[model samples]
Target: MPETPSALPPPSPSSSLPGLRFAFGTLTVLPVRVTRWDRPAARAGMLCAPLVGVVAGGAAGLLGAVLLLLGAGPLLAAVGAAAVPALLTRGLHLDGLADTADGLGSGKPADDALRIMKQSDIGPFGVLTLVLVLLAQVAALAEAYDGSWAQGVLAAVVSGASARLAMTLAARRGTPAARPEGLGAAVAQTVPVAGALALAALLTALAALAGGALLGTYGAVRAAAAVVVAVATAQSLLRRCVRRFGGVTGDVFGALAETAATAALVVLALG
Candidate 1:
């Protein structure tokens, strides 16, 4: 369930084009062509991941808002919002989450666990985890929508963006990949600590502004908290996956995204 790297065409000659291509190319089902697979591009892509998340999550939120405007019930709007990110990513992150869950739940040695993760079939743990995670996501969204459509949109965007921001932190220099091949290997430890921290600060500020614009000062605080909580939750999972699996993997990345998104939703749902 790792991100399938696009085959290298000629590298882009522009300064920033390759990274933008890499971010959208691998992180979404967007039509952009990725022309570079080098470390520099991977670094740029990792840094740009949150931007991709903003676009994807904003799209998802807009869809939900449109549904609500069309007289759809909160539950229906919530479902639409929940479905969009999965559809947008071709469920890539969900598949990764399932695989990571299977691996972590196996109670086997690291090698054995990695082997379990590599299997195509969904194990009981993976299935249960997926079901529960999706339920939590949907339920949280519904709650936000019930409060107000603006809250629902805010939750969706914040959760989505925060989810990818988690990866930026994961990719900070010094984080190791679990294996020698795959998406994790390609992007691991690609971001500088300063760069990650700066982007995180910017994201948190934007979250506050989004919340303030949508709700109020309280909303701004909560929105910022949601990002913080999401990142913290993802970081916990990343550390655990690294320890259990010997390092980060594509599946681990998926797990972190889902975890962060769900955590953000949960925090936003709190009254």
Candidate 2:
């Protein structure tokens, strides 16, 4: 039998370096050099996924702050804030959100839904999902920044990191791939459960501390709440995908990331 992605060994010390390169090269438009593309490298890449989120989120936060300083106002600043990560990631997560919507909205058998997701054309479901989600993200960012630019920046970073952390959780051992080939198969069930949980906890603490530093007690509490909700939303989506589509596809991962980010932003905005 062919070795499955789940069968790949845990990432060793030497593989960790290549994994970092692979994570950035594949997940973002950062001009990083990736010399390894095998399963071990991909697994390590999954472990390093949140680091890419850190870079992307940090840049977005910085850009939003600069725009605010330039008198761009919250709305334009929000747009720029939201647009940076999308452009940097080539809107890869958005594409996943669209595809997942299409698949789920098809309301067909698992096989049929998977087939729908594989189609390159965007469906009505996809169009609507993208419109609503993007609108929510922009609106939430605007509101969060209305109070303070520092709060907005912290929120953006938390949302991005939270979303990537969701990916790490979903990829935890035993999660199945929706198909036998493609990106999903290459990464499915690659993350170790214990390691992912530890990372998630660490990120939550760090985000809360940063939020409190930037926005005070209320901000820290709200930030932590947002991260919790975001992770729950992502996990919920992953479960639904498993039941509806037999397992997770690359699109599912994308959808989780986008949904988690939006949820985090919205929670921070209103909480």
Candidate 3:
């Protein structure tokens, strides 16, 4: 009895699968069972957030390709390409964008801005921002499609994935959560800045390689530049959110993602 020792506790279960499941489940309308709802799982979800975009973009791109092959006009194909992700994701990011716009456009104090963002109804600012961004996306994609369907597809996929990368960057360590709880608190400062930067760079490199394989040297350059634009856009938005709203919120994250995606696509179209 004098020599008796305490036993060690069992290790926690791996959260990778649950995190992936949660990411897809929360970020999209896909059927995924999220088994873990704790912070660790939430962090894991954020880490793998970009994968959801890849899947959504790939599916949307395929639909656009099929539409184009079926004699659809570039505009029509672009609409389908834009619509599929919205449908699959239930436009969560779009809704977030709208809320953030409304909040920021109010030009109120930080507390008031947060309150405005939390409201369920969309305001004039929200409506206007959504309309303009959505139009820009479709118009740019249509132009890219006119050049080549493959280019359009690549642009869509790259922008989609890059959008989520912004979220990862925003969540990097030391980022402040906007509130005591909710998505911002759950994921803010969860990712290491170095890890986020590395992941984003890796994504850009992979996109460049794919562009070179599919399109050419110019496409590769454009692809890399587009990533840079997207990341810059995201960081700019994050800075504004922190200055204007006190910290990043779920709505801010949404706004950042949509803004990054739109900017990336615009750059690709221009290229």
Q: Best-fitting candidate, measured by lDDT? A: 1
Candidate 1 error regions (>4 Å): 1-14
Residues 31-110, candidate 1: write the lDDT tens digits.
99999887778878888899988888888888888999999999999999999999988988999999999998999999
CA-lDDT, candidates in order: 0.88, 0.88, 0.84
- Of the two candidates 1 and 2, the one with more favorable lDDT, higher being better, is 1
* Candidate that beats the other on TM-score, 1 or 2, i.e. the better one: 2
Clashing pairs in 1: none
The predicted structure with the larger TM-score, 2 or 3, is: 2
Query: Among all windows of ten consecutive residues in candidate 2, which has the lowest summed lDDT?
Result: 1-10
> Candidate 2: TM-score?
0.96
Per-residue accuracy of model 3 over 1-271 as CA lDDT, tens digit each: 1111112121235877887987888888888988977666766787788887788878877788888999999999999999987898688789999999999899999999999999999999999999999999999889878888898889888888888889888987767888876777767776666668888989899889978988899999998888899999889889988999878888888899899989989999884
Ranked candidates (lDDT, high to low): 1, 2, 3
Q: TM per model?
A: 0.94, 0.96, 0.93
Ranking by TM-score: 2, 1, 3
